[model samples]
Target: MSFLSSNPRLTQNEGLAPAYNSQSEQPFAKPPVAIESYIQDLIEQRYQEQPEASVVCAWDGDFTYRQLNNLARSLVALLSAQGVAPEVFVPIYFEKSRWTVIAILGILHA
Candidate 1:
């Protein structure tokens, strides 16, 4: 016999599982916040705490937050000029290197 069938209480109360009703009262609702604002705050914190800290380290070279941000902006401009839509998923397949870190940051910025 099945495990639930072995326990009568489990079988009888199976339909009483927690259900989410949008029309009903919500106890966990919170104010909405912009993701970009959060990201900017994190970036600012990193810069202020460790301005020279290596944010991306790879086989080729390591990058500080300043470098990564600059590279990401350059990449965003280049991709935008080439008609790369913000909604597009640009696939990046490459070996581990500084370029990989740049690509990851670039995608996030895009």
Candidate 2:
């Protein structure tokens, strides 16, 4: 048995992530999730599920899940105030650091 499948033939399907799903299963079985709910879940998971988990460890500093989620939520508020919505693209430009990770999640949550 292979890591991806019991059949070694799966090796031939490299570069395709969809190969992991068996053909017996529907391609889109799960129902669509609302953007608000998805963002809320992401924030809640980071803040509530594992608040102490370190999400970013930069040379200058570090941030825990709670901090990142809080920053993300704040970004969400700012974006919402600016009338940003789903399907909208937010530009991200930041140097690699703890703040960068927080900014990425913040933009994503927004």
Q: What is the C-alpha lDDT of each candidate?
A: 0.71, 0.72
Model 2 over residues 1-110: C-alpha lDDT tens digits?
Answer: 35546565644455356655453256577766657566556667667778999877889898887777778788889988998777788887877777777666666666
Q: By TM-score, how accurate is candidate 2?
A: 0.56
What is candidate 1's CA lDDT for residue 55?
83
By summed lDDT, the worst window of 10 consecutive residues in model 2 runs over 15-24
State how far residue 96 of model 1 sits from its true place (Å). 0.9
Q: List pairs with backbone clashes in candidate 2.
A: none
The parts of candidate 2 lying over 4 Å away from their true place are 1-43
lDDT of 1 at 94: 88
- Stretches of candidate 1 off by over 4 Å are 1-41
Q: Lowest-scoring 10 consecutive residues by lDDT in candidate 1? A: 15-24
